[model samples]
Target: MSHPWFARPRPRVLAHRGLLPADADGIAENSFAAVAAAHAAGAAYVESDCHLTSDGEVVLFHDADLSRVTGDPRPVAEVPLVELERLMGARGGLITLRQALEAFPDLRFNLDVKAQAAAVPVGRIVARHAERVLLASFSDARRRTALDAAERFGRGIRPATSAGTATIGRTLSALAVRSMPLVRRALAGVDALQVPERQGRVRVVTPRLIEAAHACGVEVHVWTVNDAPHMTRLLDLGVDGIVTDRADVALRLVAERR
Candidate 1:
């Protein structure tokens, strides 16, 4: 299902949070409806963050605590997956890593591992879909551990360096950055470099950045893009992938340009 060379959809669209609230669907983030919308919208890949529950089930959730989404101020890990499911009844339903895999059946997934404790269990969950799942994290160290476990479990891991609203890749390389060595090592273990689009008032995702990451055999995926002009700019600059809220817009933009 996860074909690395599946013609690489033109400026591949990764529907963010399943195209939630942004569209007519009132489906909240981290809910099943959101995922469905993302896939239905023709997103080739769907990205979501996952956290562990008390019963050790790897449940799909974006935030670490229930305070924001659930309106309860409890840590998700402290609640058993069952209880969480009970709270998130049939409206959305709690989905385990297994459920996600079985339900989607080949959708390429990028999972953000929220905690180090999640490493082993998350690794085990994604392993079943090795050919299709890619694990990403802010913590290179945590990503390394997850990748190791994923390898043992048979899933391929992808190294990531999020630009966090800061445009990255405008610079040719991280050669001058303090964490270059660590990033290089992390890049060696994975296939892609995930980053943001803005950096200190200077757009970082320039051709040089794409060239640099590609030179190291790392594909670049830019995230959270919500506008068309910016999308066009990145594509012209040769970005490998674009994660956005408007998959429809991305698809339309590419089609119009073509």
Candidate 2:
């Protein structure tokens, strides 16, 4: 049960999209430069999103369309990798999944399968580097599809995975009833549960939930956290990892805790 993802220190600091507001010379998010910055900051984990281009190339990008990042109205799946690189070159250059794995050999990546088309390719790539990758998505089906692809291509070892939304719901329901058997079964094969502290008006990540996950030997990592005090609070609550846009501060805080 000793997975490679847990080899690092507890209360992991996973850089969200490789840290934001990067150097003026680098792209702000999900760019190679940003990834380098996170590595330089001494972060062991980085969280990013994946999408497939029109030509079937997998790139590390968030959002279905380019409007937010590039101010272009084109969907990622509609653009070819060559043109997408050209479009993103000045920003920080487009980084493919393979490039990321090759470029950061020592870094562990937590990748979200952003597009349905990206699932299999992401799996094929991660399958080659199973020990250092964690595959995830909002859709359980998409996550499973990627795992299946990895199994087919990975020579049989599946990468670490966090629970998707549906799996989370099932696990939470099992927890509500205090059913250990159900909790164990619901969390089967999941290495972790990465979720926000809250959804809409409902609060997640309560003490009981954390305890339940810990009992199953599964980690609880909360995402998109940016403030130091809030990070401290979550850590105090026994979260195994923190996924944040401000990894610089989180790193310092973790050191302070030590």
Candidate 3:
């Protein structure tokens, strides 16, 4: 059986940083308003980032430093949550992971662990609500460490996870050689393979790769897709999920098809 995280509708619309489009006037990514916007637009899942504040609070802010988002040259871990909140107040208010879970009870979340300090805290927090959470990271070690922490919490069921960069590389390598055994081994603990439609010059999502993943009961999710034509192309390519910055548009397009 597929994990509960995959039990939702296929061609899942995972709102990247909560549907904050590049031209969005006021809302900020990973903020409470962003999440609310995604939910209000009929998105069932929201993809977000998590980092730890200096005061040790786990909040949803993407960058390691606040320079781009807040124009403060300090790292996120050096800023207190109160200061973080104040900075985001005008944009869309800082939102903690816990507050998001509580505020949007019906929505599922795809959480990318962005900081080392946030791994354990994220695991512990998501443990109580594992059914709707998918934990991920760019680092395989960090991903496993967070999973291990969740296991330590005695939740009985670990949250679903996507393959990290290392695992994705290994899987792609195995698939290129047509080594099904190696592919299975690489995807052992992962529930999904979240990847870009293309990485530089190499096309990442091919029919062969998608077939191989589905053969092993793993779903393929492509990320950061924004355009409708690309979204339609990917859906035609048989991907199971689309992580996008334009969730509002994606939702409408998907619904129109249905």
How does candidate 1 fare on TM-score? 0.83
**Winning model by TM-score:** 3
| Clash pairs, model 1 backbone | 163-196, 166-198, 167-197, 167-198, 167-199, 168-204, 169-204, 170-204
Residue 144 C-alpha lDDT in model 2 = 91
On a 0 to 100 scale, what is the lDDT of residue 248 in model 2? 96
Off by over 4 Å in 1: 1-7, 21-26, 155-186, 200-202
Over 1-258, each residue of candidate 3 has an lDDT whose tens digit, in order, gives 677877877889999999775566877899898999899888999999999999988999899999999889999999999999999999988999999999999999999999988999999888888888999999988888888887788468888999999999999999989999999999998899999988999999999989999988889999889999999999999999999999989999999988
Roughly what TM-score does model 3 have, to 2 decimal places? 0.97
- Candidate 2: where is the Cα deviation over 4 Å? 21-26
Q: Which has the higher TM-score value, candidate number 1 or candidate number 2? A: 2
Each prediction's RMSD over C-alphas, in Å, is 4.2, 1.3, 1.2
lDDT of each: 0.69, 0.91, 0.91
Superposed on all Cα atoms, model 2 deviates from the true structure by an RMSD in Å of: 1.3
Q: In candidate 1, what are the lDDT values of residues 36-67, reduced to their tens digit?
A: 77777767677788788877888788888888
